[model samples]
Target: MASPTTAPARDASREALTDSPPVDGARAPGRRARMPLRGHLRELRTRSLWVAVGLAVGALLGWALYDPLLALLTRPLHLAASTEHRDIALNFTALGAPLDIRLKVSLFLAVLVTCPWWLYQVWAFITPGLTARERRYAVGFLGAAVPLFLGGGALAWWVLPHAVNILASFAPEGTSQLVNAQDYLTFVMRLVLAFGVAFVAPVLLVALNLAGVVRHEPLARGWRWAVLAAFVFAAVMTPTPDALTMVLVAAPICALYFAALGVAVWHDRQVDVRV
Candidate 1:
């Protein structure tokens, strides 16, 4: 019923209404402007708060499980005592040492238990800058890293008793070991943490290769150094007098490094093909 000119004007008005800029001032429907520094700080603050909350809750759980955890950690000392036929005591010189060690162990357990959550938070914070392919790589990195680290920690536990036995054997015919509780705890933690971190180091190499930060050829060429480093690391971490225990620890690390190297070579080839 309207005139042609009036119909055209109506269409124009509708088009204007539909195509007008958003009230929020977004340039396009699905696009957003870069967040300001304050926004990023706020986001970081929120994520950090959640991480702290997770740690606190995990620490509570660790406290509840402290008895079993302590028992497990001290098993190496017990084994050493039995095998060496000597008195091995973990002495606490300070009155507050017990409470301090408990708190420290609980915190360590909390960090281990809540690692996946905190790692995801870290990944999430950096994800905006990554492409989809990079995101997939990140996910795979997390999945592989966590298990490898845990496995390495388990291996360290298995190796502990032998290392303890060997070291304890070095004592004179009648001397008993009076180890400080804090010192022993620190040693155990460092050994376990070192093994875990060492296992994860290969995964980092793969990540670097994926990011094109390092080439596979260099890794291949450095095989001898890798072997040497693996032995040196085993020597430092395990402190065994014989080659057998050191080899047992070093073998897995060497295998993992070569495995990671293979992965890098394969990935580099694929990238070459794609290019």
Candidate 2:
């Protein structure tokens, strides 16, 4: 025969036990559940392994296609030599230069070929932290970034002949230019990467706006400076004396900037409405 007070206390204790979640499922009070450091490390390792495998496979493909790729890259140089009426030679000066070039180019191709996969791995790693809206924005940006980068690279390749012709035309009369294969390839890679990164800049700006790190008004106000900067960048990159080539390179960049600005403005309006 338990006392009335003891019975009430027993009932309360049983109710509490029944209402509480199991230990394995329970989260800390007043906080979102988080993965442990070890779990994060494991996840990172797994993704890194996958990325490495992808690069390896891409490298094999690049190795197989090395000759065709090399020919494609040097076609511009040959075109420039022909157009400028200059005798230009690409020579491997060092004993192991050919092997080195092959390896480097293969690695570069691997990176380019496996870009989408690695990018997705990166996205997957960071996605758990993002809200639904942020994930959508990230996906959109990532999709745009790859195509824009590739387009920029293509644009650089298209302009390469003109740039080579202009630069080679500066050589003194009766001097046959002997260019190192390694140095020329390095120059080509740098130009391609620079153009790719530049094209991706607008996407970054739009992303910042969407993420609330920047506002649309400031970007809109700086259109004049942006246009000037674009032309200057184009001039530097193209290395052509004529304004036409510079305009061709700058026009696309200007268009992308304005497009990004428009997106920012639309996003801001949507945010305001929500607010």
Candidate 3:
């Protein structure tokens, strides 16, 4: 009874409905396919732009504060020189050595200042691939890392003058000992880096335990070997062979290991409760 025109419209509507896909059993296209390499590259470029900005800012700050930074870094030498009536002079074999050292120091300061930004960029890039639990762990470790590194650096700053004194004691009287600025800076940098890394050992161990990669009992059993290894690391990394420096480095590592063990034990207990 419908008109011919109405019948055609109805037919067209039915055809369209039939041709359209059903939602229940249909699968959406993957994110990877929907956004291809070009899109990914564009995102990466944006992130990199931000990182570059941060580095540039850090470099500017470093350049502005170069004199103060140099003074702070040379404090140990200054203290030693004052005590021993000696001078710490920076010798330059090359014509550009002094300028090069300044530029290098500026770069180092910039990198140090920009570390958090750089770390965040790296974390942001990788975070999309991590699960919720992994993200939690990453955040936890990062929160712990700042304090641990600061503690280590503070310890180094406190002990370094004494260590310098011990080393200067070996020089003969009236010789007018001179320590090269470049060499002194390198030594201080190495010591600070070594201690900072050592202090974070516990956080790493606890993370491994939480990931189920290592267990409490094995770590507890490995204590003897761990202590020995700590001593070896101290001996190798300490700038001086002085017993005080060696013990100062080793003691913290031992403490960190035990702290890690305690964390592992607690984690194991929680696992037992869950089971």
Candidate 4:
């Protein structure tokens, strides 16, 4: 019933219809690639499985090195007690406490040992969505983050002895400074982990800068806020409530924040030049 003059238009419409994808099975052209909820859940499971494997391997390593690591952790206690001519050491009030401590230590050590691997697994999962340039920045971020974390842990380790000495010096004359094993270990681990995470946070800020999500001007103008945050983090995280120890904790982080700011500024300049 179509007019003869519209025959070419009808033919072209039919051809286009034939070339078009099926509505039930295909996404529209120019739509961004997005995974369904089911796909996201599957990806999460896969990443979790690999992370568990890394933790298991790290646990084994922790078990193998338990004795030496225990000694290393107890060094500050030894130094403090020995200086006071006392043999006061970590004590447990319950029967199964030793086993509990071992399990705790193993778990914590596993987290520390497998951190980079687990982080890489996380990155690998998210990388498919990122551009090549974004991937490069992410890898650079991971690299910078790992070393800074280790360095922060090292700083915590160094600070612990001084902090211990300061606390012990406050003990009343002729009394031993007894400590609960579980509490001491928990405190020590939290301090190290806190410092480690704090150091890593600045890397995220720098990464954002590199991604053009944040500018150097705001970051530079917010130095006071950063310093305040550093002090608050230190006050909350450090085991003891000493001003000196808090200062020690905050000082390095503030310095690192400035360093990160400098790097981000330079990187923004480079990006501007490129643009």
Candidate 5:
């Protein structure tokens, strides 16, 4: 019923109204599209702050326990020397070696002590980005990882004294073993880290399976190869060229591999049901 000019103006008004954003002052549609990026950045900053705090706390604790920690770490060396009436003397080749060892030891202790808090912060930061199912899987993985890693570390601690004894036995019969402090610390740290990380292999496999990257059938089929690889890894990681040490490291990894296979199989079945 309107005239042509008036009709054009009315249509233009309607188009403008339709194009305008909502009046409620909530996020604009375009702005909402960017929310994820902004949220991710915010989370990154928060996680960084938390990680810094955890590291600081760890450093302080490390400093406080430095002496006792050093003693505990060196107990294996002392025990190894008990039977031979020889002392394990630590020599510093470099003038700054003592200070350097202290600093390195402090950092190492800090990382070990703060691992739980650091891991939790990382998990918390990434949790919001994961699906509910993924979050559940992550929680389970972390729960299992903590104990598995700690058990591995404990095993290393137990076997270390024996390993030290075995290695020290090879020293010339009448000579006192003079071990470099830095070298001894480095050796122990390596063993602890190797075993601890090896125990987490199952968790990694399970996570891959849950993410649908790998399924159980392939893992089962490759079981032989996996066993061989685990032994090879153990051989490489063992500080001493001893068969027993290799077996000790390999056995646990092999067990973890089989466990991972079971988890992967279970996950595959769940995925099939959902599909």
Candidate 6:
């Protein structure tokens, strides 16, 4: 019923209305992809299964290397024994202590040994949520995490003898120091794990920066507090009263925090320039 020119105008108006952004400048909604609940549950099961398999393999390998690992763990005790000239050796009070210690140690060692594989599984699970830039950052984080974790363990090894010596000093001059095998090994394993987590924590701070959850200024300004907290954390967690061991543990963490802050600042600069 309309004329040709009027019909064209009507079509143009309709197209404009459909094509325009929303009133508040928000983008028009598009069809979003969705996954069913069953699919999500299946994905979680697959990832969890892979991680469990990796842990099992690592634990098996650790159990296989039990003799060498035992020697490695006993060295600090030996060193302290030598310093005191007490000929002290680790003793098991319970019948099943030896086997139980190995099992527990293997479980802890599995986390360290299978780190890369389990970390990849985590990355894969989250890959859908990450942008390309975030993926690249993730690669860097993984690279840094492994070495930092190993370094922390090595530092713990160095600190252990000192810690053992300090703790032994508390005994009276003539008392025989019989170290409990289970308790000592558990303490040592937990110490290493704590240090490993502490070392890798800076990676998380950098991640927050990259994700724009935090900025560099606040982190940099918080340096004094970071240093105090680091020392306090080290003192509480090290199981040693020696200031040297606490400082050794705290110093690297502070260094890593500043280093991560520098990276965040660089990233922010690049973004500002791009903008």
TM-score of each: 0.84, 0.86, 0.77, 0.75, 0.78, 0.78
Q: Candidate 1 residues 42-71, lDDT tens each?
A: 878988998999999999998999999998
When summed lDDT is taken over every stretch of 10 residues in candidate 3, the lowest stretch is: 24-33
lDDT of 5: 0.81
Score residue 47 of candidate 2 by CA lDDT: 93
Which stretches of candidate 1 lie above 4 Å from their native place? 1-33
Note the Cα lDDT for every prediction shown: 0.87, 0.88, 0.78, 0.83, 0.81, 0.83
Better of 3 and 6 by lDDT: 6
Clashing residue pairs in candidate 4 are none
- Compared to the true structure, candidate 6 yields what TM-score? 0.78
Position 242, candidate 3: lDDT: 63
Q: 1-275, model 4: which lDDT tens digit per residue?
A: 87887989988999898667545324333222367778878888999999999999988888888889889888999998877666568888799998888888888899988888899889977876666566677788888889999999998888888767666767777787668999999889887987888899889898788768998989999999999999998776655656888888899899999998998889889988999
C-alpha displacement of 44 in model 3, angstroms?
3.1
Error of 3 at 49 (Å): 3.0
Q: Please provide, for model 2 over 122-150, each residue's C-alpha lDDT reduced to its tens digit, 9 standing for 90 to 100.
A: 98788776665666778899899999999
Better of 1 and 6 by TM-score: 1
lDDT accuracy of residue 86 in candidate 5: 75
lDDT of 3 by residue, 1-275 (tens): 87889988998999887666535324323342356679778767878988888888888788788899888877876788788787655566568877776776777777777878987987876565555567677899988886798788777777677778768867888776657667777788777777788888789999999988998999999999999998898776655756887887789889899999999999999998999
Off by over 4 Å in 5: 1-39, 231-249
The candidate 2 region of ten consecutive residues with least summed lDDT is: 24-33
How many collisions per candidate? 0, 0, 0, 0, 0, 0
